[model samples]
Target: MTDDLQSWIGRTRRVADEMATPLVRRMAALTDRSDVALDRGAVVPNHWLTMLFDDAQPQSQLGPDGHPSKGDFLPPVPLPRRMLGGRRLTYHAPVHVGDALERETAIAAITPKVGRSGAMIFVMLRHTITGPNGLLAVEEQDVAYLEAKRNAPAPPEKPAETPTAEWRDAWRPDPVVLFRFSALAFNGHRIHYDADYARDGEGYPALVVNGSVSTLFLFEALLRRNPGRQIASYEARTMQPVFCDRPAFLCADAPGADGARNLWVEKDDGAMAIRIKTRLT
Candidate 1:
């Protein structure tokens, strides 16, 4: 069983190089920064390039969940659902708009594990992105495959809640925000915006929020907390799904001894949705 999936461990693909200007402009517009001027060689923001080289599968090839049926590049795991588990990103240099860029992605590791919930498969991919000036960034992105309709156990009880946070902000993302994000990122996963499919088809209590959106919220709050800090490296791990109906709060601990700051998203029910760690220059 593992052998079949293991064949994809070293599989690699190189996406055609593309100009970054148009994508950067479109992303700015989606995020309500249309007034920001982007020149040919201007630096693009971190994590802005989410869906640059996706496979263009025709409509007939898509699954009921609104994702392209597996097995083209991703291994055909038997699990019926998949979600981003986390990512570690190293920014070697600023990525500039209008630069010719190429990305090479390889399956780095595939492991099967069992947690309190049930069986799971984790697929880790190493993505190296390059520009005309050479290496720009490297990221290890983890995606998890799970059995459809599996009931997630209630999160473990926590200690007495802290009365206050070093920094905190909260907001409930409505369906419109989710829809606009999906459009900007070119993500077709129905769990994000399709309530009926997310409920009856995916076993979610509400529309599932995009994992990247959680990270984005935390990043924005981090900047607000420490104005003028430049991110050197960033890492995040999604522990559970954050639904659109629930309010998300970004909370951060004071900076650690090594200058790394810890941040996490608190879901409406008090469970942590994701853990984030970042270092600054």
Candidate 2:
């Protein structure tokens, strides 16, 4: 690692640590699904980003003029980065409210990828979240920065299945509904807020949506699908880029037990946007 990157990473930790607790609480509230009577503790999005970027150096490091380094955040990848493809989602269990959890993050892998779209970076992150009792869940996510352009939709795929306590109602997600969610979540990732930055800075063709936002939406789908059922636990992995102003769908299934359940979520093109399993009390 370069000195510039190291220094930037240290600084990034300081900023992120200060923002951790509050950020976690806020995100947990924003993602909470279900209205049932389970002992559901909420989860925040900070654990994933803050922990995974734990060693990130200052954004102003990298070189004499303060360029970005390799281990850093894609050096400001192009906005409108397209989603080339994705796999299925699987949750170990559901996450409940008031569950004091600790999260540690790691950069799983960084691969320079070239596909039909063009040159891109495939960033994979691994997140481990431990609850008050013990280790709760571990999730792996893949983010692809693909060449941006108008194109055909991806091919469809099937959702994962798991034995559950019972069946759940189906939930639908529309692109237009996320504006209010983004505002409520305080997500400033630019992709979730600004369209211009998405195109010029990130190289994306359209406004980028928040990965957490989509996960929250899918969680909401689970709750609405099975009203009166409490969400005991949940784990989600972001597998692709979900664009703004597009149509998407939530793929969910029956619950199994208090500890294990099977559930998965995807986008309009049937991309495995998230794979989650929840436990209901």
Candidate 3:
């Protein structure tokens, strides 16, 4: 990494926000969990934090890709495309709605590499969340930047093979769902809502689903099936791009001997789009 890029490592920033009840209810509604109590004192799910603390950059500061222009909080890599690569989170305490929360974030690492498509850069960020009660959760997130590829050809499809699972749920994310998710995260990425831009500009066959949305769905499914099971820690990785309006299956295997459950989002073709591992308290 260039010295300039390396300087981004360990850079830290702190911000505060409130866990508003209305936003919590909106999140529940987005996940199709309107039954979730959104009373002021109700506990907010840790996964929902993904939609909070969004970078509210001014319109003039946004790049053509709709994200904040680089060289500010994040390093300015010349790459023209960006996406959420993966995340690992540890829940320390329950965060309640209406609580004022603080988040401290740091750039943990910056890695540059070459891929089949071209040059790439991976940024690792660490976030510590706290409330009046003290520490709430610690999260490590990965963001990837890539070279822009307009009209890129789709990869060849592989043979379908069903994965074993103890529980499964089907979800069809229409444009509305994608749009709402994008809005909730303050994500201005056109690929999630603009089908034309996604196809001709990004070379995606259809609108791409947000990685955080997929992660949220996995957690919702897990918690719904195993109510009251507290998640101590969880890690997730996006294996492939899941498009909007496609029928996807959220699958979870029986807990292993160590009590860690394996979860994944399976595309209609039986490919795993995202995989997760979680341990309960």
Candidate 4:
């Protein structure tokens, strides 16, 4: 392992936390942008659970990419660009609005590999969040870092036609939506907010959408379609980049006999950007 890689492995941080009632209501409101009425002790939805914990790094301490200067909890990968590659979440119990929570974060692994794009580093982070009752969720998230891009490539061609799904909804995500979500999640990533930096610095076409936000949207759609259903497990893979320049649609197939569900998000151009598989209890 490289000196930097050896330095980051096996590091961990545990944060004692609580879920404030006001923030719960605010997240529910920001979620649909409608009049959402929530009380203090109400059971918080799984999707909104992520809004409880904040990274809490001071602004001055952030890096040029707008994230907290790495090497603290996360590894200081030398690559200039970083993004979420995918996530797998296991939800064990429902969290209430005003519950005391504890979150433990650790660097599970740092994998170095060479791909078609270039030299890459895949950092796997394991987050275990527990509530007063018991363990609430265990999530494994993949964070990828890559070398700078010299030439921006054209976007993928639109699929011939979008596949039909039993349950689906369309969303037109704008800058405001992305900004509000970033604020709520305490994500300071410049690629999601800075158009010039995303284009010139990162070689993206426009401000990129947050991958977690996309996952939440799919989760919200799933819950909306099947009320009162709790997700036992969820695995999501980001197939393509979803940009702010176009609309995106969320589609889900009917559940199988085993109660397993399949879902995906398709860009306006009809390309599938994310695929989600879920098991409900």
Candidate 5:
């Protein structure tokens, strides 16, 4: 594992740099996402780059039965376990088309944590991608996996949501959105696009969703629920596979003693999909 981690340190860096071009192209194709249109000649948007930061190199082979066997982090960073701690980003310069890039990598930290979820290993990885001219993007990603199954006790039920403002924005995700995000991240993993590949090849019942989108939705939920507050540091763990079209439920509670907002999300059956802690201002 030491040798594998060493190799991954450099490989993770490379993936960060190569991520921009595909990310820009793929994000520009999202016909219905936002008001900001990505001009082909222009550098990609902050959101697009944020999406790209999830890029990772293969660290190991899947087990004989096909799922990532225990201890395999091939497809490092966004591990199958859980992730948290991603926050504010500044787009220093537009990552333009054809910008050759490379990422500088470091194992920022690794330590043990104990919580209601039991023992866990927190791995912090820093990636800086530089382009033909200068720095394209810099991201410090904190990834963690509970050493044991993370089962959050059920929350006391709240009243049904009766909207003051009209319930707006499409809740369901479309195929195109998933495809565009997958392409942007340079993710060739079949679980996101090919339903059959997801079920038979990768062992998901349906086309599994992209984790980046979940991150975005979770962040947005934080903003909507806690207006005016700033997220200093944000972390989210992908606890289980989230597929396209599944309606999402997100929650962001007041900050804990660590000065970070506690946020979490899950898909239909309520498995822990993303566990997040956001630093507040």
Candidate 6:
């Protein structure tokens, strides 16, 4: 199975999309920044790039989990569940609204390993995004696939003490926000919006929050404190699942001498749900 999955390492695909004003407005609305400038030449938020180049799979092509059936572009991993593990992004130039963009994605690596939960397969995907001017950004996304559970809820983890931070902001994510985020990202994953499926099917206590949304909250918190600072690069890792309707705290440390900052999302119980490291230009 590993050999078969390894064959997908070099697979690549190219997709093109436009940064429309309406889309930018919707993204602004999602973040409660309805006053964001949406003019043609206005720069789109760096994290908002996830909303572009969506893979609109046909209804019939979707799997039981709501994602496009595997084996075409992605490898056919035998695991029964998948989730976002982490991402590293480097921005070279700002992507403005109305600019037509192209993205080239390739499978960079595939590794199978065993962890506390069980067997897992990790896939790394590399994306190079370009605009009419030149290269905009490059991203490496990590995706993990896991063995199916028997519908039994796993033991809960002990909560950790929250770390102190220079800046902190509280955010409550409800179903409405999760649904809007899923819509914006063109993600049809059932766990993000389906409470019943999340509890019964995935053993989650409630609807899971989108990892991308948590990352966005962290980034926005940083921006709130340091306005106008351009992000040169950032890396985010989802340490745990954050359920919808729960209040989470976005915390960030002051930039170090090197201009790099540390950020994280703290769950209500003080557990660190996500950790991020970012550098400013």
lDDT tens digits, residue span 1-281, model 5: 23344444433434434433445545545533343334445543333455544434344544432334434433243234444434323334555555556666666665556554455556776767677778755666665654323344433443333222212233466677777766666555566777776666544557766667766666665555545543444555555556677776665555557665556664566455656655544
Q: How far off is residue 153 in model 6, in Å? A: 5.1
TM-scores of the models, in the given order?
0.90, 0.51, 0.93, 0.91, 0.54, 0.95
lDDT of each structure?
Answer: 0.78, 0.48, 0.85, 0.79, 0.53, 0.86
- Candidate 2, 116-172: lDDT as tens digits: 545766655555655556555565556576655545544443453333324333344
lDDT per residue (tens digit) for residues 216-267 in model 3:
7888888888777667899988777999989999899999999998889998
Query: Model 6: clashing residue pairs?
Result: none
TM-score winner between candidates 1 and 2: 1
- RMSD (Å) of each candidate, 1 decimal: 2.6, 7.9, 2.1, 2.7, 7.5, 1.7
In terms of TM-score, how similar is model 5 to the real structure?
0.54
What's the best-to-worst order under lDDT? 6, 3, 4, 1, 5, 2
Query: Mind giving the per-residue lDDT tens digits that candidate 4 earns over 249-281?
Result: 888888888888788888876678888888876
- Per-candidate clashes come to 0, 39, 0, 0, 17, 0
> Residue 206 deviation, candidate 3, in Å?
1.0
Clashing pairs in 4: none
What TM-score, to 2 decimals, does candidate 1 have?
A: 0.90
**In terms of TM-score, how similar is model 4 to the real structure?**
0.91
Candidate 5 local lDDT, residue 265? 60
Of 2 and 5, the candidate ahead on TM-score is 5
Residue 136 lDDT in model 1?
77
Off by over 4 Å in 3: 150-163
